[model samples]
Target: MSKLPGNAGVTVLGDKSVEFYRDPVSFYGQRMDRHRGRVFLSRILNRPTVFVCSVRGARELLCEKSNIFQKDPTDLMTNMYGDTIVTTNGEEASLLRLSFSSLFTGNSLESTKGYVTRICEQHLKDLSSRGQCSYSVYKSLGTQLVLGLFLNVNPDEQPELYQEISCLCTQHWHGLISAPVNVKVPMWSSGFSTALEAREKLMAIIKDKLQNDKHGLVGTLGSLPLPDSSSASQHLLLFISALIPKALASLLTSFTLALSGNQQVETRRKAQTDADYLGFVLLEVQRLWPPFIGGRRIASQDCTIAGFHVPKDYGAVYISHAVHRDPEVFEDPDSFRPERWGERNAGQQHLLCSFGNGPRSCIGVKLTDAFLKEACMYLLQHYDWCVDPSTQALQYKWLPVSRPANSPTISFSRLDENPPGHSGS
Candidate 1:
């Protein structure tokens, strides 16, 4: 611990255990300045950890795919999603990604088009009915779309399934982020117990679906020729976490923010069907608001990152907030400009680490890309968006993933009604 680059004994933000609990990005951003943008040390919930901000350093730590940087037991992915692709290392993670590879074929995606279209229409219709949308609406849309796409639930059962999912996601978040420090002492927590109960209930639904030969990711998992028997366990881990919820939040936030300003998207309002433009907008949103901010890796043995020694078993944090805002890579590091992502900036697109990058990039990247593109096309071809300036621009709440801190008031009216302030494609 003493060998790390910054002053080992000092606390950042001038507090013994500085409170960045609600705002880790700011904490790391300040530390990045203090350490000259490479690396620094801080304690998350009072646990000693290393914070690495440089793009090259993050890439080295995340992309290496070696035993030297492994998943720590404390990582939320490992804690909440044991041994899944996000939480595993090297060959095992590689193989898990490979097994899911078949799920992304052109033919497979094409088959999903009609369903995706229907889900989007229904979700949009719901938004229109509500007149204004916020975090709950977005989350509900994601959960509904997920259940609608993944399962063949009867119309009567859809509400119940959504309720179950909501409970599970709520409890999962509670367990993942808000439990007590001494809660490891067993008697200190009922939250963990509640989360476990919710998990059992959710898993029961999954097991029942599997027994009845259901569809979507559950069926895809076993049929994909996974490399190990633990594939069931790994698949179970990944599904229990809210993949759709995070993506849903990202999609809504990005699209609304894109429409609220950005002349590039305005040009495409109705005249252009350039697939490239839609992709670029989504990419820009993610670059600004990555679904998950950076990630955690544990050193398996002694290893050096950008000349600083990372000792064995030490936890390393890679902050996306810092990496995404690199001035060298992005022109006006903090502005919301989608035009900056067009053809002229193609060379740096690879630098966008929204869904992560390199060998073990997000397992859901292809599925998510297909989903986002389809959603973007639906929005561009359908309704225009308007932000309620009475409401603020997107502010964040950093959980295991980033989500809107509050339900900002945003209107998504239909093309026909065309409210004066609203703009449509």
Candidate 2:
């Protein structure tokens, strides 16, 4: 039993902790039922934990003095991702971040527009030919787009390797959701082994490109401020590996919305524009279904959050899904409304934690935005897509990332008229 802070009192939750661990969203909501502005200190994962259900408490934990609250990387993420930017903090995090930031400049993103557009068009053509597609769009298209932009490869060229990387990411999530507290899981060991293999393959590809001076998309990476040549390659590979999983996870969540018939017509119409509807849809999906249960930060010293006393060294879990759907912050918390993110509410923008906030916010956000926008716009513009009515109210399994439990079978038909700004193939 872990010791509680002087200011905090522990609430012993027996099997309730198991229920919360099993499904956090539903459990959190149920625990907060009929209680307004209450902070509960409950046991989770067999550890004494503070569960902040109020919006004010969550905001203070995440935004206010967030530096004191550090991210506690899980065993699975640490083993697979290691000390890469996603799981690292302090000076090392800053240095690696600075070196990688150079790769996402306005010019770099603009330069890759052609690659993004080309991939989008190609994917649309392939899907259209299939007539009925039930493939994991994240695995098939989203992974390729992010990998191409970051590492400069056509994933299809090395389908087996790409498939392995995708499987590793998926399995990493599986281990997290299913593994018990005491077990020395095989999934963790396997995930790490697979990650190393994928890294070697990626390095080989990068080295081949560098040796042959095959300036494909990697030409854009030349401007990055790596400390040395070796570090540059290492950083590039690690960053790509870390980014690919998050990118695909987010993309799959957005695809869930599309399969639910949320924005079929709009996605098709906006596929040709500089801004993609997938961008908007991703923002919406993230708002609806965030990847993580929010981010965790350990308190540096004693603090008060929404009236609850948080002592030094305590961990704070910011529930992003709860904050994103807060009735006070959003108009209708449960409804899917993409237009809320448009120019109309530009001034009254709600502080969404999907990309996080402050200095530690997501760096690959622009690349993610670009890829999603391009993919959604292309798919929506060229094809009419919807989930087969036979399986309409499908539920998504949320862990590691959100994805549909049932086969998301969507049908597509090529449009008779070309979408605006798009030149039909």
Candidate 3:
């Protein structure tokens, strides 16, 4: 079969790279009408890649034929996390997921709801204390809450470990992932060595915590009744490294969207009705600005997406930006309209690929949703926040996690701080 149309070389890849870096928020929509269902072949960071921008393709790759598909992290990623669930596929991944399944549902989910509220409230209080919080600050607060809820890290009480791990995971990943290539460069030696050492130290802290008790619903494996064939410490490391970036990005995106939306605090408090406007806001944000623009998966045996022939072990990257922007699926797909989600239930909701579709869909969804709801509720219910009117529209960097490249400033005022019947922000 003829190769799918795309920028596999500088000839085709050049424009996409430039635009993605230059303007992320509006870039996808600008090209969506022209590129939907098109597979663009390109080399990213010198690696050959295929970006399938179709919902059907993503569903098949991530779900329908997931049996043959597998998780494939970079060589650098393999070094940091050996065989944790995030790195493994097939039975190994299942066991790791099973070991942690107890924490995903039932009593565990019910118990963690309180922590969600408390963490959001505390973080907002901290944000308010620093009146001029930027986009980066929101991400930091989200990361802190992720740790507090999952691993039980008390950042205030243990600043060293908290700050150290954050540095290693968030700031130092590029150095760590490039260790092999940088080993021969004299100037890169310090960063290369530091990455390895930091990983070890961070793992030690995580192991100690998991062996003791789970911070949120991630209870110790030993305490659970299910059979666990995985190392809880390594699993914790996998999740900690994997989840932190997405956690930060999602918070930034959701917060940015909420501040931009018309929904009010009083409007959100009355939940469980047909018109839960805030929930719609969250879904629409994910649809328009997913934390992860793309995800990688390997072809199991063989498959065809939109007439594309993908052989076994062939690498594929599904671009969510393409999938979510399908005009056939989403009307006025480029615009932010939260009300579209009001009537969507579990059945037709599959049309949205914000979390991907099928077996390999993101596991962090439930927790992510919880955190978003908690954060949104806390912000809207207790404060009036606004994006600086002078700042440019939401533009982001996709790598690591999708966040505003410029780090724009946002202001928040507690409800009580305002005069009675004060309306506009």
Candidate 4:
């Protein structure tokens, strides 16, 4: 067995050192190609770690033996989420998952569709008037869209607060990347404070809407068959925290990509045929730029995987980025191909690892798809947009989420000259 440097519990094959603190996205494609079907173990300080890179290996670690392999609770997620479903395991996790499943059911999705469409349309209108904007469009658009879903607040109504909230979420996400070390940072402290303030602001909105019982998203959530007061409040907080960051990240990434694509020529008809093009794009992005690189599991007892010896209490980390981009599984794996996810192959789209597979798969997948679809449809129909080619080579930072190190600047012009519900207006 290979030994890691400095007595770190991690062991890498040959000279391939494990990089726990480094942003995995920086070498995402390369790592997948080099280490597919191999196991590389390293220690982040004193924590024992393992990185499984192949699709089959990851499946065994994440799905088949998931009970033994569990999610490690980073200080950041634990601080923000407490023992919420995203960080928990076993029966408690399942129960919490079940309690909130209704919020994302088919009927719930249908109900939110119109609201999503309206929000998307409203944001597009705002962007159209600007002609061009450079502040992280994904963060801006996603904040409003997610806030609408959570509290029914329009993007226009809370632009400043939304911006702050987006920043706070982004900061918190970065905290997760740095993990135990970041928890001690002064910046992390300030970010948490900001997040708490934002939460208060959000709760205030919810409280006000709860009092009014108005026809808003909060009103809708208020009407759900919630558990007891404590559980219900916990549910609300967890749901908001869990979703806000991801929704914002996905929306921003999608918006950035959409705006960068060929938008000068009218392509409304093409966009409609792919009603969920944004969702597809986001899915592809998740595959390409997964925020979380590894899934952890503790060995229940001595076991061997792929001829590697394991002792009881050993922890395994399934490197999802490596699995998602494995060349053997995906053709031209580095290229973005949304068409591969069309209806015909939707059933065959199991190779992606944005969401883990089997019982632990992300529960929010359906809702995410809904939000992505709506955002994509509205943007494609209403704007002619493109990325600045000079900025095309922008680097991405992998923290709380994968985002351009610099905000992707995009220009947009209204397709208002073309009528709504018509292609190429």
RMSD of each: 3.9, 5.5, 4.1, 5.4
* Candidate maximizing lDDT: 1
Model 3: lDDT to the true structure: 0.62
- Candidate 3's C-alpha runs over 4 A off are 1-3, 7-37, 44-48, 73-75, 126-129, 175-193, 211-219, 223-230, 245-249, 261-275, 344-347
Sort all candidates by TM-score, best to worst: 1, 3, 2, 4
Tens-digit lDDT string for candidate 1 (144-170): 555655554433466666676667867
Task: Report lDDT (CA) for all predictions.
Answer: 0.65, 0.59, 0.62, 0.58
lDDT of 3 by residue, 187-287 (tens): 55656566666677777777677667744545645575433434666656666673455555565555554554235444434432333666777777777
lDDT tens per residue, model 4, 1-425:
33321222434432232344456544444543455435655454345555666676677776677787666654356655556667777887777778667777767767888877776676667775665555355545666666667655554677776565555555544434333431235544554554555555545544655667556445665665543444444444555553455545644564455436444243334555665654565666667767555556667776654455555666676666677767666667776675666643365456655667767777777877677666766666666666744556567665445566676656566676645543221
Q: What is residue 357's positional error in candidate 4, in angstroms?
A: 2.9
**Candidate 2 lDDT score relative to the true structure:** 0.59
Runs of candidate 1 exceeding 4 Å displacement: 1-4, 10-18, 45-48, 65-67, 74-76, 154-158, 180-189, 214-217, 227-230, 261-272, 389-394, 419-425
Best by TM-score: 1
lDDT of 2 by residue, 1-425 (tens): 22322222344534255676567778667656644433555555444456665467666776676666666655345554456666666676678778777566567667878987887787667665665555355446666665676555566687676665555545444434444233335555543444455556666665665555446446645655655566555555555553455545455545544533433454445534535344555667777777665666666777777766677766666677777777766778787766677744443333767666666777777776677666666665556655665455567655545555564666555665546543222
Which of the two, 1 or 3, has more TM-score? 1
TM-score of each: 0.85, 0.77, 0.82, 0.76
Window of ten residues with lowest summed lDDT in model 3: 266-275
Off by over 4 Å in 2: 1-18, 52-58, 73-75, 155-234, 242-282, 342-344, 347-350, 417-425
**Which pairs of residues clash in candidate 1, taking residues 3 or more apart in a chain or in different chains?**
269-425, 384-424
